[model samples]
Target: ISLIKKEIETFISSYNKSLQQKDKNIKISDIKIQKNTLSLNINSQGIFRPHNALLQLKNSISKEFGKKHKLGVREIKINNYDIQFDLEKKPLKNVTIPFADVKFKEKQATISLNNIDEEFLQKNYIDRMINLVNEKVENQYYEGKGEFWKLIWESGEKKPIWTKDPTEEMTKLDWLKQGPTKGKWFFRPQATAILKTMEKIAVEEVLKPLRFQEIIESNLVPFDIWLKTGHLEGMPGEFYYISEPATRDVEKWERFVDLIKITKEVPLEELEKNISTPAAGICYAQCPVIYWSFKGKTISEKSLPVLVYDNTAVSGRYESGGRHGIERVDEFHR
Candidate 1:
């Protein structure tokens, strides 16, 4: 880690010197190394310029590390950046009117609003909503001259326009350089927006009716209790520990695990089953979960169906592969 940090710092110095030649006012404030991943905090005079610099830095780091390390921009703070243009807030065009095609048998025919099919209503509503969203997103983030959104690839090519379904040509084209993989899915802004929009649609149109609620919870959970509950079945006992340094002290590690197990009263067999290694035992001190939920028993049939949504960070271990990217990482938000 120290050696990697030094290499990163040296690269940053050279990168900054190059930027000076180009009259670019961007510099790395700090470089944080976490295992094999690098997080860089940057300061720049413009918003987009910092992103460009980050991409360059990532590419440089990837070349330096030779595919063993992953790099990410932890944060970018623009010193004097300002939004110079406004998104034209125009009314939606081609709005679809629900039930507009309904035919009346007679001049005085009437229909109840409730009589509309739920499936039809939902489909139409979501279609119209998605259309409006797409229009807004396109207008604000269109890729062309005089557009509000401007993104350049690491290869100095203009990014293609955002599409509902990116074509083979578009997908093959290079756009961003912030991930282990280099393809359409690695374009952070577009990919993140697409995922978020899909999740929103699922929650609002699909899962919402199924009694699932969007929830906000911490990713960290009691490790022993987590194990006792049989949450990490089948998978190996691999975890990212928050209090890892304390585990080096034998007494503290034992006391920590003992305290959690005693508090939760986890069965001895279950504890043994979960904590297979010293690392796993120490990781039980601070385990990360994507999400969790529990409901109290109620004797009413109305409460028979209980649903929950857990969205949080999860950690896992994986062997190295060329296909690995943001999708498959040691720590990721589900």
Candidate 2:
């Protein structure tokens, strides 16, 4: 028993060190061998899932303790660690107080009303309610799309025209509908020719005349880039995240391919459990990646303003609602 405990402790220390090196916020809080099972209690930071971490650890354990060993991982328990919030900032305070007997579990806190003034609290509470109402009204007004159009154009003050007429000529444009998703579509020869013509006109007549130099850029932007640009902070759920496969584990890839071939169905939940953490976010806009090119460099006076464009840039965005047509799609070329 002593020898087993020593070996376990050494393995745990090495595993914890590896996790630290990888900057993962997970560690085995406790481990015990009962009968033939090896139970591990994982303590992770707030909201951090240990799926990938545990997967790697399991692989490590399998290699360390041979495949024939009787050790099996049945449960993975996560205990929440206390998070400290700044009280001086006067964060959102809940007004409702339960009348029933409140039983505090692992963590306990005491709220004292003795020093707080009743009249002052009431006044602030009313003020908070008013502010909340004002905020909601403002949000609704801004978020709600209003009828607006650009009437004035370069060719004098001409108004845009639209029609919903059902004609054979117009209906023929809808030749392709074999897109994998609702917002994506496959353009047939007819539609493709028209699209190519429009692209040529837009480039030759509009962009080329303006001396816009086209440049090709990657569709994937590192997660850290978005953080530095403050876009992720503004719209946390707007962009699709990209994850890489466990390329080092060749057997895992083979197993996945075999599973797909046999089942003819994707095991998304299983894949999610085993896949690595997202390394980058899909390009939400072309401009963000363009800025990345100028990183770690100084601009001279001669290069006052950089003029560049990317016709081949494909952007992806996760829209929560208000999707009408192909104009607003999950993936689009700008």
Please, what are the lDDT tens digits per residue for candidate 1 over residues 1-334? 5656777778778887787677566666666667755556556554334545655665676576665665444433322321122223433232232333222222221121222332443344534433444454444445355736666755766777864434333344443344353311345575567667877787788887887765555545555545665645433445444332423556535755786667866555534543434333222222233223343434477775546565543334432444344444443444
TM-scores for every predicted model: 0.30, 0.53
Instruction: Show pairs that collide, candidate 2.
Output: none
Off by over 4 Å in 1: 1-187, 231-233, 244-301, 312-332
Candidate 2 C-alpha lDDT tens digits along 60-153: 7657765545443444343332222122222222322221111222232222222222243334443343344334334544565787789574
TM-score attained by model 2: 0.53
**Weakest 10 consecutive residues, lDDT, candidate 1?**
103-112
Write down the lDDT that model 1 would get.
0.48
The deviation in Å at residue 172 for candidate 2 is 4.6
User: How far out, in Å, is residue 183 in model 2?
Assistant: 1.7
Q: Which one is best on lDDT?
A: 2
* RMSD to native, candidate 2: 16.2
lDDT of 2 at 71: 48
Task: Give the number of colliding residue pairs in candidate 1.
Answer: 0
